[model samples]
Target: MQVSAGQAKLGADQITEAERGLLDFVTIEDGLGPQSSRRHEPDERTDQVRGRLDAVLIASRVAPLTRHIGLVPTVVATHTEPFHISKAIATLDYVSAGRAGLRVRISARPDEAAHFGRRTIRRTDAPDGGQPITELFDEAADYVEVVRRLWDSWEDDAEIRDAATGRFIDRDKLHYIDFEGRFFSVKGPSITPRPPQGQPLVTALAHQTVPYRLVARQADIGYVTPHDADQARAIVAEIRAEQQAAGRAGEPLHVFGDLVVLLDDSEAAARARLDRLDTLAGEPYNSDTRVFTGTAEQLADLLEELATGGLTGFRLRPAVTGHDLPRVTGDLVPELQRRRRFRTAYDATTLRGLLGLTRPANRYATTAA
Candidate 1:
């Protein structure tokens, strides 16, 4: 489930009920967007809203309130340091008791770069001195690698807490990850202890070869947008091939389709609702994912059909949070259960276990072994 902070009324108390058994993971998008100029800022007279809430902070705030649902927040790799992100996510896992995951993202927008002013990103279409889009994906892969290393920097049993001897931690259990990369270098034995899940779940949305490669090499789960079963099959095959080439052929990697849904009791009603929303915005709503306007039954049917093409699950984007979210939780969930396609209850505590992924061994530990 994808929730937009700008649109959703996800107050702290409201989240507990909203995240009941219906959702295994609640995903929050990185809401960074173009900042408003003083002239362009909305006055009280206009209802337009602009500023975005940080994704990771929002997840952290809600982690204590919800227990079973995994809190996955988007972390942009473009200008952010991997070490800081690693510690923050590790802390989230501790707060949530291992129900934490990260949606790794990369920013290509020039306006986003201006906010940082640390590095200038070249436009993808620019002819000269511009960084290639491939480089961005490569850098993102490196970013995830460093973060994963930091998560494993302190072994699981590093903390001994031997008060009699006044020994707080086992120094021999701490390992330094000497990572040197083209984009950045990290020398680590993370200040944070190993997270509960060892390495918190890493996910990415891939729409092309470069990003698919990144997901294949790094992500535990990959979100893909496909229009039909054939497209889904092709994307899955490509990702599998890439995974095999990366020497992770036997690893468990989930491929989930991304869908935007506007559901009602009937198709016409759903269409009319979307039409009304488009009119209010003064344009048609366009999205990279397939947009479905139909009944909950129809949406469930589509998901099941797409699953045949090897998609393990879906990340649904509601057209309107207040209206569509309930439909997903109350209506669509039962519809999926009726078909015996969805889980009746959360069987696992950790996000990795919820997704049927085993906790990966610490890379440094395996190296030492």
Candidate 2:
């Protein structure tokens, strides 16, 4: 939200404070072009901040400013090249010293599609139904696949920089990744070598079976919106089934609940704040995800309850970033720590390490046994 208001420094300050608060990670969602509507089409409402800063660039800018906290920026896969994304994120990994990850998303808005002019997206490609939506998600899956393969195209030991031997790189370590899919085709090695973590974390937000399959097939983390614990449990179960069907049940995947929160010192104050915001915006607070209005302790209690439903963690969207983000980092985090439910110190340095994900082996590597 700070970035939306063109306050880049404030946004960086918030993230640094979040790191000091010991939060695991922060995701900067991009609105390359946006509509405030749920469909993501253009809307006439001008009350909200409509300006968008590129998510990756913002993360890269903030990389050297903070340490330990993971920087996960949103990148829309639609109309984007997998090779470019792979290079950008790989560079981000280097800039952040291995604390970078990305949440890959797909844009269906005709307005957003108009930006690249690569292809026209009809309104029929809506999120509700049709083969078009499935095709988009499938393409997104392929995009992730290509990005992953390209990350491994240059093996871990490809860069030798051996000036003594006049050899800067091991050419034999580079491998061609010939990937052909229904949506895209790419040949040869990526210009960027394997990232520090081998592969940075891949994530997506899944609401149904199609997107769930994408999450199962590729994502290291799946963000889900569930209104209640029962729904959370069911969603987790469904994603787990999809994982098994995708033949990736053996791999560890974290399912994180997504919530929109308006936090305060008291539950009443929180509700009042939400009501005020809604009144100013001239619309009731509405969202696809659950809305939480409560004290930090209450929010923490809710989180603990939801975690029992199989959610490994949560991604809370602050209704007002300036207010609620501070509440989350200062108040809610301490309450969780007091309950001995949260970490008082960062447990790991890298984003993958923080998430308990082991660094993946570069598939193209042929090391001696």
Candidate 3:
């Protein structure tokens, strides 16, 4: 029953309340855009100001109000510079005292590109005119690879203090990644020191091979939406295999199942509420995986069933964040705690600890020759 919130009018109070209740963490969705290239959704807030509120600002606001809750911000990698992202995430890690994470998402539509004053990038049409969108995602995967290396460019002990000698850093400890790639290139150590967490967590969602491969290599956790238990296992297997192929099998990479939840006291009441919410949304609430609607106990049982797929955990997207988020924190968490499936109180303060993830060793750490 670990909770995460998104960028909706769902009020920051809901997030604060959830944190007060000791739910795992609150994630604010910062990435914003239109549905398609042609239509613009009606927005009361100015687009320029609103778009900046995406995960970065939201996480910043949430960080100070609550002390222990993990603050994960969604940072879209498609149109952003890797150098800038490296600094921003590092700063977030400092602000939150190492309780920050980044949800690395790849954009799919063209409208988001126009906001950055760049020509729309089409995944389907290749620069060579032969490859498809699949190839473009492969390129994006490489792009993320660059970001990961940049984040790890400076070793943990790179900073030094020698008062009499007047030296503040060990230059030799700083290493240049000198990463060269198809889409972009990066050189040398990060301007910022290694994050407080050594390497803050990076998570990405994947529905296809390219993303799966990217998750296997670049992400600490990979989110997958599978309709059935068997599909979840297959996806995990694929990611594990990719991890081995990429020489990253030693890292603790978690495959978390994603679900859209609508929980209530009874089955009938849950259905009625879901139906009502769908009507409000103006379309039937459909997920690639069938939505889960029932009591919190039933939802917990379903979560346990899904856990058999060797998943680290589940990320439930509530049908209505305002209403359902509270239910998740109040009802579902208590049940999980009773079963010893989740922590009654945060055993550790960092995001990695809350997720039961280990602080990844600095990539530059190696045995002496």
- Candidate achieving the largest TM-score: 2
Regions of model 1 farther than 4 Å from truth: 1-14, 35-47, 125-127, 366-369
Q: In candidate 1, how many clashes are counted?
A: 0
The digit string of per-residue lDDT tens for model 3 on 1-369 reads 344433334346876876755766655665557332123233453322343345677777767777787777778777787788887888888888988888887765555666776545555564754335565566667766776677678778878888999998888778788888877788857788888887778887788788898899788878888877778888899999999999998878888888888888998999999888777656686665558889999988888877777777777777777778888888988888899887777678788887777777767766579
Which regions of candidate 2 fall more than 4 Å away from where they truly are? 1-10, 122-131
- Alpha carbon lDDT at 212, candidate 2: 89
Candidate 2 TM-score, true structure as reference? 0.94
The CA root-mean-square deviation of candidate 2, after full C-alpha superposition on the true structure, stands at 3.6
Report the lDDT tens digits of candidate 2 across residue range 134-159.
68888999999999999999988889
Q: What count of clashes does model 3 give?
A: 4
Instruction: Please give, for residues 1-369, the per-residue lDDT of candidate 1 as tens digits.
Output: 221111223445445645763576867776346333232222343445565688788889999888788888889898899999999999999999999999998887666667778656674647776567678899999999999999999988889999999999989889999999999888998999999999899999999888999999999989999999999999999999999999989998988898888989899999999999989877788888899999989988898788888888888877787777777878888787887877777788898888888898877764454
Candidates 2 and 3, the one with greater TM-score = 2
Pairs that clash in candidate 3? 30-54, 30-55, 123-133, 124-133
Clashing pairs in 1: none
Best by lDDT: 2
Error of 1 at 339 (Å): 1.1
